[model samples]
Target chain A: MKLLRNLFVIIFLFAVFVPFGNAEEKRVRWKLAMTWGPTLHPFVDTVENMADMVETMSGGNFVIRIDASNIHKSPFGVFDMVKLGQYEMGHTASYYWKGKDMSFLPLTTMPFGMTTPEQYAWFYYGGGMELMQKAYEKNGMLSFPGGNTGNQMGGWFRKEINSLDDLKGLKMRIPGFAGQVLAKLGVTVTNIPPGELYTSLERGTIDALEWVGPGMDINMGFHKIAPYYYTGWHEPATELQFLVNKKAYDKLPEKYKEILKVAMKTAAYDMYIQNYHMSANAWSTMKEKYPNIKVKTFPDEVLNAMKTSYNELLSKYKKENALFKEIMESKEAYLKKARDWTYISDYLYLKSMSDTE
Target chain B: MKLLRNLFVIIFLFAVFVPFGNAEEKRVRWKLAMTWGPTLHPFVDTVENMADMVETMSGGNFVIRIDASNIHKSPFGVFDMVKLGQYEMGHTASYYWKGKDMSFLPLTTMPFGMTTPEQYAWFYYGGGMELMQKAYEKNGMLSFPGGNTGNQMGGWFRKEINSLDDLKGLKMRIPGFAGQVLAKLGVTVTNIPPGELYTSLERGTIDALEWVGPGMDINMGFHKIAPYYYTGWHEPATELQFLVNKKAYDKLPEKYKEILKVAMKTAAYDMYIQNYHMSANAWSTMKEKYPNIKVKTFPDEVLNAMKTSYNELLSKYKKENALFKEIMESKEAYLKKARDWTYISDYLYLKSMSDTE
Candidate 1:
């Protein structure tokens, strides 16, 4: 009886302490490939941040390996790498795959796009994310906001684009839907990765390259060769997404998903935070580096012309793809409501300050 | 005679180019005030952010004068008057003055505290002005993130607090500092005016309070309610500053003294930005809607007993203030350094994530 009682006590203790018993029992190693190099684009910095968060939050249970930049291959390969199971997770522009489905552009960025907070509201709470994830399912991946860039400056280029005439046959490096619109206008559109952009521009390979914005471009050394800066024509409300193979993500326990979600969330905002720092530094440095590097805005005619082109591009997609049309229509409807409030909230306040006080 | 002809031609061109007649004269008018009820606080906010900025930037062509706070008899004067000052100017804490400063707190927040970036960096770069000026400041005053709000919690209480024992004292209504920390300790601190504090605590109206961390405490609110909440004790860091006296501000030429330096500048980091919206709402609604509230931190015995007390109360400050002292040695040394990096690069990057890709 004494031995049996002792055995029973031991069994109870084991049951009580089982969950906290071992450290190595639950650890999982993850390889997270990031396109952000050491210190260049804000998006890359954000990827590094997410990798760090994943390790810490999981109490070192999960470790992500970020291969910053396309050290292995190319940044555009991010989507397929994860899909083909070459990588567990990777980051890429959603619209880059617009060829898969043009509706993907809205999922990435809208021209003259949704404000950051508004996009957050639509994605997280307003059922927009659910729709996006549904769309990504076709490609064998899962998606999250990853991050929302506040807004972007136009872009930097080599020459002054004063009018419609300037855009003609311009061998511009642009991607996605905006590139499609430029193609419609008589500009020769070329899509090249950031890695090759410098040499191409220097060798007169491309007339202009519409990269992220001032900060990333400046770091890319684009200011040295392509001094003419213009805003984005292809991806405006650009959103960089992290793609995880659906099969791989499904195999993980619920806990891993939570960590990934939180890590991804952290990465999303960090991109904007990094961009804020990079942009300020770039603005100051750009002028000092090049005397003739001029910064100018596109004329109203140009802005209006692009807006009209955007309408045509979007309309064609809507006619063919029911999903693209639905998301766009819904996004527009929600924007109408939000924008109305913004007039009272943001615009008028500025106007009143400019006028009254 | 030939040299004299050349000089005459130069003089002719100078006269033609000067064009004082076509200088296109410009004028602006504005009014502002501070929250200190007609004292130097109000004067400082109005003068610096508003009147001073205008006069200096405009080269003294404009002039503005802000009436004192209580002269207008507004304890929450900035809140009511700022909308009127929208085109005018007024000043208050983003958190304290939050009934109105709610939309502005992201500029301030004490969780990690307002770094110079959020204080000035975000304000100037992050569309903070459009949000802050148009929404809160424009209620009457065009706003400026006048100063810093390093990092602070709450004040002290009379009772010997140990865990739940901390909250036994009754009637704590305060804003700014000690509210969140002590409340987490189960102490219910509330926002009480400086005038009403002495009367309330003496009449057994309250238990404890927190003012402006350590530096401003002795003179502001803590000194009066002394006997607890040790100096350099409860709140190790708390940032403060003023808003513009808009009317007095807008009337200035342009470019003058107190240009309200860059919020990220080493000096401007001393200004305040904002905190949580819940803080102000709590202040306005606490006792009137909820409990009369007793608030306090743990006793020295209990504080020492608390696991993180020393680190929370002192150690981190030792490192930061050391750096601060190296850069600035006024004892408020830590605050300057605190604002410079704590929020933006240090705390923000440490705590926040950046990318999806």
Candidate 2:
């Protein structure tokens, strides 16, 4: 009876404490919500990639399940849900939360702001990341760069934008801050649902609309209806963001936390490259099929007017929010030095290549 | 006695089988050789970052010990060491092996190839990875992009290049294929050890030299002596490589393989951003301290001559190596469409901004 009792004690200790001692055996399950629908490429792919990496790196011990907007049924409410800890994290653009806080606007991108690589450098090495954390700390959430859309195209236009007069009273589906900037330029800016954008352009209900770059815009069939595609000035490096509930993040084991952070960072950079490839391919196909499609940049007069309005709006926001003022000032300072490097390196290189051609 | 014997058998099975069932308990140790010295910034940082991520993700079960050139005493010998399985892997550039094979040349960067983002897109999505693997299959190694140096400056010249005559018989310390192209244009190209480069340039042993971008070159004090800083035409996207022994990689557990790959990828992208930030800060400092530094682009007459010589050299190699031809053709095809996208997106945006300025 004594031998049997000793054997039973040994088995119990082995079954309970042995697994507990090994961190890899500790299982953690998490849920992530995304503002994008299930079918959105690159965005959905970014979430899936991050989750897969976390699961694999943890050896199946840590798993993240993603919920698309269709499943969550609250695309714009992602910020509130993640803040309330209803989900461990959420993937969405920071600009979407501008109504709740003006500081969230410039966190995404700005008109005539840093390009993709420039913005990435600012985020990782410049004071941008600290500023971002300061903006989110009050909400009990940590925010990170989710993914980048590279440089977005201006818009697809039915008529060529020749001058400032061309933009006056123009009916366009331009959203957010850009809409306000355009409105000040005498453009009739209006918001339209994504589904209605294509038909609106086709029927001349809206004379123009700005979507994403060629990658996401190709699917909307906007190029078919609108022959003029304008080059981008607004949203130069539109970065989506990941919002993490502070409590949930704090509870993760040290190793799991590193795993999750690495996974998110890798997935974010991968999405940028993935979208670059997609746009290159999509634009090539679009150009081959629609040879008449004209690529245009807004005339200097209109661009100058747009810039003035953008500055005026920025001044208004700066006066209203101190945090917004701090963030923009940091960005402007970084941009001055970073853009000089860009000019000598990538910009001049491209200019030289084009000159020879 | 029967009960005791059964107990012994159960304990033996539990101790042996439980650890085997848990993949996390499997230990992996790897040795990596780096072509760079220990003090090299961003390059050495990339290798350390990858190893650190792998160790953390594996919960310390997987470890990679890195030996830099100083410890290994063979900077250029990394390829052979990794290929022969003397080291499990190496961090080096593919173009260093151009002496043994011509196909290895373009794998790093070409004279007028794609920029950093474009090259990354090609590697991951535009069939460049497949071509790279095919190039290394015979060597019993696998190649992955280790990091990018972004766009390298043309060189620091003591005199501005105004015409084709300016380059004729100019003694420059430019190496590899770019040297051959310059040689064709009547330039006397020489190779000087890195430690001796600064003195050589200052003493006029070499009229000009290209090291890397401002991030790496600022430390070399070349700008202090040379006033003419030309924009990059060669090595637009210089990508370093991670060379892995196939047998060692194949021995890794499936989950470990994924972790290793994800770590390598994240580290590579991080290095590019890091270098960008470094260059931005370094250049800003250098410019302020030395306001006399002049940034110039080679004249059209000289650029056109370099292009002709570059094409001739490429044609010579293409005829000699079938693999080189195949790889270059694929790049040219991808560049045609990719450059179109780059022009309308980033290039035009930068151009417009500069025009306004």
Candidate 3:
């Protein structure tokens, strides 16, 4: 009986402490493939956080071994790597995969689809997530909102865009449906990486550019070269998405999946606040740091044109992209509900306050 | 000599096996006070992340021991605690400290103050931080944007507010300047701790409540009882702030202060995203899960009245509060920049887009 008791004690210790209890506990390794780098603050912040969250929650059962040392060439290959299971997960925006399916674009930004709050509402509850999941079905991934820029800065310009004619023949950096509208206005538009904007703008290679608001733009000092900083029309709300290969997501234990969702949500929300908070201070800093810079707005005629183009793009996407149609269908319903409340609540309240003075 | 060699050999083995490098790592620990609980999501997220960032940056020499578990109480207490050195650090908003000085309210929110992004720019770069710090000088605290909900939901209502008269005699839950404006509309407004709002609302304690936008209000399940969710005007550009004890912050090595600033910036941006992301889904969830809940907008007349009140409140604050004057002067310059951008950018962009095709 004494020998048996001693043996039992030894077995129990091994069961509880060794090999992390089971197959699940041993994964303290994260092998991540990247399309972007550490400078992509929001994405990097979230990915780094997720790795820590997963490790702490799993009690060393699972760990993400990020390949930060040699990040990938571009995000373009990240999807395939995630799908092929070279890494456990991947990060990038759904809109970046427009070539795979235009439906992904509506899941992202249009000319004026939804603000950060509205977009989150439409995607999470308005069946947008289901649609997003379905769209990614072909790619073998389930996606989440990884980062949000809240509302974006319109664009930076060398010359004041006081009229539609200002866009004519002037080279500007822009993208998505807004680029389509700019094309209509006869603007020479280009799509380039944000890192390259400084030299391009400095060399007079480009007349204007837009990037993720102040948190980043201020860091790069884009305002230094672009004296005419304008608002209204290019990009209103840009949401960054983190795409997980569906197979890997399915492989996640239910608990880890929950952790991932919570972590992603936390990261996404937090990034928006940081950008906003920084933007407020940076606005003042930019002026003091770069006195030559002028914060300008796009002209009335240009905005009108941009809005019309926004509708045109929406209609076009609805007709051509199944995902856009579904999203818009649900979005329109949600929007109406939101606007209904706005009319009486926000609209009425503001008007009343303004009139009181 | 042989004894010494043996000891060195043993020490080398210990160092090689246990991350026990020869270089001793010095660690400094400090307590942090916050207004919310550990499970408050965003704060937790920020703490978790900021901890990682600070530790890594400091080579693990600096560590923050969070006292969130016991520190959270009426937000009203956190600031004073910081000022009194009851805690080493803290997280709260400027508006919560209005009792300290009404001028401090401008550091948080003004009538139709800058939007989340714009406010961030102004605070960081627009010389707003220097002024804000000046406001905080008397409190033994320094402040910055810690978090933001972006543009908030107007409010929840028991009855429709269609005209200026409708607000008369209506009891409201408002704080800061917006509340004063509600008073101007002949409304018998009241203020209460947010934790107690549900009790007050359920007991028919207040005619209506203004908390946050749909993203937040829906979470509190306000729509379930209050069928009418009004939009716009209650608090247009409400922002959250971070209050750091002056002595504590001053004592922090400049490196620690930078971490605090970076952490706050990250949190502020993240908060904006959280509202939109969660609210996006929450809105649809409310509508779908609670189909009976109705969303409506305030009438134009009511909005006009609110705006009038907002302007009037602005003027009143300017006249009655020195801090208000300081903020208003700085804000006037910022708003002029914003207003000009609004005319050319947002206004025109909408117009142009509407006219296109």
What is the C-alpha local distance difference test score of each model? 0.53, 0.93, 0.65
Please give the DockQ score of every candidate, comma-separated.
Answer: 0.01, 0.69, 0.13
* Candidate 1 Cα outliers beyond 4 Å, as residue runs: A2-17, A20-25, A35-40, A69-71, A84-86, A192-196, A199-205, A225-227, A232-234, A251-253, A288-293, A347-357, B1-94, B97-357
**Model 3 Cα lDDT, one tens digit per residue, B1-357:** 556555555554454443322122234576667777776655456556655555554445567777674555545677777778777667666777667677777776665556554566567556788988888887777777766665566677777777788888988887666788778889888989778888787778987887776666765777777777665554455666666678777766554565455555555665665555555446657778878766666666665676787787677767888776888789778865653333333344433434442
Scored by TM against the true chain B, the candidates give 0.53, 0.97, 0.83
lDDT string for model 2 (A1-357, tens) is 678767766775676467666656678998999999999988999999999999988878899899999999999999999999999999999999999999999999999899999999999999899999999999999999999999999999999989888888899999999999999989999999999999999999999999999999999999999999999999899999999999999988887888889999998998999999999999999999999899998877888888999999999999999999999999999999999999999999999999998
Greater TM-score among 1 and 3 belongs to 3
Collision pairs in model 2: none
The DockQ score of candidate 1 comes to 0.01
- Ranking of models by lDDT: 2, 3, 1
Please identify which of the two predictions, 2 or 3, would achieve the higher DockQ against the true structure: 2
Docking class of 2: medium
True C-alpha contacts between chains kept, each model in order: 0.00, 0.69, 0.18
lDDT of 1 by residue, B1-357 (tens): 556555555655554444333222234445555566554432254245444434443334345666666566664656556554442444556556533333343334433223333234344444445555554344445544554433333454555345546454445775543344445555556677677876677666787655543323333444334445422233222334345545555553232222322211212321221221112222333323334333333344444333243236334434543432221122223333323222222222211111100
Residue A245, candidate 2: alpha-carbon lDDT:
97
TM-score winner between candidates 2 and 3:
2
List model 3 lDDT by residue over A119-171, tens digit each: 66566555777887888877777777776776566777877877777778989
